[model samples]
Target: MEAALDAGADMVGLMFFPKSPRHVSLSQACKLADMARGKAEIVAVTVNMDLDGLSRINELVAPDTFQFHGSESPEACAAVKVMQGTKIMKAVAVSEKADLEEAQYYAIVADRILFDAKPPQGSDLPGGNGVSFDWTLLKDLDLKKPYMLSGGLNVANVAEAIRLSGARAVDVSSAVERERGVKDNDLIRAFIAAAKNA
Candidate 1:
């Protein structure tokens, strides 16, 4: 967490879903969030959790924003915002042009949108799958809410990815890892430097 903060990361993602390898327990996540409180925005990433579940997390983690990466409807996203009074970032899985349509639906409900690569069939995880979609698909994307690009991003290709997608922001996970769920300080620094320079 300190490494990411020192690298000048604007936001840090903390998963709440146990199914994800990156998942952190509520107490652990809250502790980390507290540590990064003023340094960086903490995002609580979740799947198809109910309002009660979300309420619990909200009370504990107090994230700056909530990122819905599951099959959450626009109403559900809106409901979460009303309930927690925190910003919401909706993740749309993109494998083809048609998938971009989902962003249109979420623009009305979310504060921001994240365009991530669609996970492989039967994959347990949603985002951070180390899979990338065709960047050209987002070449001319223009939406009411700003969107960030995610998936398969690293120091080597993040600049090209941003150039091709015209993305002002990007989210990376597996690409900077020394192993699954274990982040490498060197890779994190390299990625931040490369992205900023790009």
Candidate 2:
């Protein structure tokens, strides 16, 4: 993360999904978040969450943004915004035109949208698979709120992804990890460097 920051990443993310090997306990996640806070923005990624869960996370990590990566309805998202009083970033898996429509619903409510690749059929998780959708899917999109481009992004492909999608900000979890969930400092640094220079 220090390397990524030095490489010019504007934000860093910590995943809190149990099904994902990248899941971080509140305490463990807190240390990582605290490390990145003020150095670069820290984003706490969660699935559908309850109020208590959010409160616990907020108390521990104090992230600058909450990245919701579940099937939470727009109304639920609104509730999250009200309860947490933190910027909300909603992730939508896009594999088709309908997905873009879905992105609109969250646009009105969320502070930002994360365009990610759709999880495979029967998959319990919605994102963090490192799947990259076609950047052209977002080419014509012009919105009131800024968005993050994600999915299948890595040092080798992120520059093109940013250019094709017109994304100024991006997110990655699996791409920087050495294993399923453990992050690699060198890859993280390279990714940040690659993204900034792109």
Candidate 3:
């Protein structure tokens, strides 16, 4: 986290989904969040957590934003936003152009939208699958709410991905990992530098 901060990362995400390799418990999230609190925005990433669960996470993690990375509806996102008084980012699964339509509903309630590749069939996780959609698919998106592009971004291809998608911001996970669920400081630094320079 410190490495990413020093590399000029704007936000640091801590996952809460048990199924995800990157999942962090409440206690772990608290510690990580505190460390990154002043340096960068802390985001609590969850997958279809209920209101009670979200409230508990907000109290413990104290995140600046809640990223819903699942099949959560706009109403669900709105509820969390009103309940936590924190910003919400809804992750929309994109496999094709029609998939982008999901963002329209989330946009009405979410503060930001994250476009990620749809999980492959039979996959247990919703995101962080290390897959990417066609960047050209997002070339003409002109939504009212700001959006971030994610899914298979890396230091080598992020700039071109940004160029083709016209994305102002991007998210990376597997690309920065030395092994599954293990982040590499060098990769983090390189990715941040590449993104900022791009």
TM-score of 3: 0.98
- Predicted candidate 2 versus true structure: per-residue lDDT over 1-198, tens digit per residue: 677777777887888888888788888888888778788888888998787888888877888888899888888888888888888999988888678988889999999999999987787878877777889878869777899898899999999999999998888778898897778999998888888898
Candidate 2's error at 58, in angstroms?
1.3
TM-score of each: 0.98, 0.94, 0.98
Model 1 agreement with the true structure over 1-198: per-residue lDDT tens digits: 888999999999999888888999998998899989999989999999889989998998899999999999999999999989999999999999999998999999999999999999999898889999999899888887888999899999999999999998999989899999999999999999899898
Ordered from best to worst lDDT, the candidate numbers read 1, 3, 2
- Using lDDT as the measure, name the better of candidate 1 and candidate 2: 1
Candidate 3 backbone clash number: 0
| TM-score for candidate 2 | 0.94
Model 3 poorest ten-residue lDDT run: 135-144
State the lDDT of candidate 3 residue by residue for 1-198, as single tens digits: 879888999999999999989999888888889889899989899998888999999887889999999889899899889989999999999989999988998999998999999988898999998899999888989789999999989999999999999999999999999999999999999999999888
Give the C-alpha lDDT of model 1. 0.93
